[model samples]
Target: MKKMFAVTALVSAFSFSNVAMADEDIGCGLGTMVFDGKSGKVHKVLAATTNGTSGNQTFGITFGTLGCDGTGTITSSQKLAMFIDGNMDNLARDIAKGEGETLATLSEVWGIQDADKIAFNAVAQENFATIFASENVTSTEVLVNLNDLIAQNEALASYRI
Candidate 1:
């Protein structure tokens, strides 16, 4: 239908506009990585945290990935944080698996490197998310390597597009 076609075109235009407006390279340079469509200037990233304490016995962890675009350049970096309350090993495993998988996928998409992954920082903090609050949990940070991401792109150039 003509109406349907018009709506689709409008939606496509809006989607591209939003993508163009997104903060370049989120979760990288700044203290707190900006989430998609978040409107705010990020001058400096002083600190960050991620905690997963939903219930006394329930198991879950808060995970976040931040990337930032270098000033006036395409160069960027990313920091990933995961907060765990149940088992430390479980948390590590989750990061190695769940978060790791996502990071790898993102690296390929964003042209990041594997060796660039590093523990950014960690600190104990008290986080109160409505009913669930964590008092003594350490927030860990992980950085993504940009060079490796580029190599991946080079290797997979043919498959891309």
Candidate 2:
């Protein structure tokens, strides 16, 4: 009787172990999108794709800024332009350590180890577009999250926005 209870408890514990080990969904900013009006209100933010492709479209958000245009809205395009927001070398080091120090990690991380180390890649069309879009210029204070960037890295499973 006591032995039966112990066996059932052990089995139940094992059954629940896998669920406990499930990976947490890490939110990383791939990079920021900035719409510099050249005269009107400027906007910027970290971006995410709907279906993980340009065909899928995108969405974005600024962390600290407040305003109607503060959120960066993404658009579909064959190609985009952007600039590196952080030190690439530093971004690589964090990824090698299985960590991220910056707001955006995809470029810096992938630049160091490729898709094997992270979840996304610059080579893939979907990732490439995102990276390109992130590099787009905007007003100061716009930043990217390393985790968001790494979420798209190929080593990890692709994510839904």
Task: Point to the candidate with the largest lDDT.
Answer: 2
Tens digit of per-residue lDDT, candidate 1, span 110-152: 4434443332101011112211223333332122222222234
Could you give me the TM-score of model 1 versus the true structure? 0.20
The ten-residue window of minimal lDDT in model 2 covers 20-29
Error of 2 at 108 (Å): 6.8
Task: Rate residue 110 of model 2 by lDDT.
Answer: 31
TM-score of each: 0.20, 0.20
lDDT of 2 by residue, 1-161 (tens): 99879845643443343221111111122212122221222222222222123321222113211111224454211001122233444433443444555413443423443434333432232333333334432211122333355455555434312
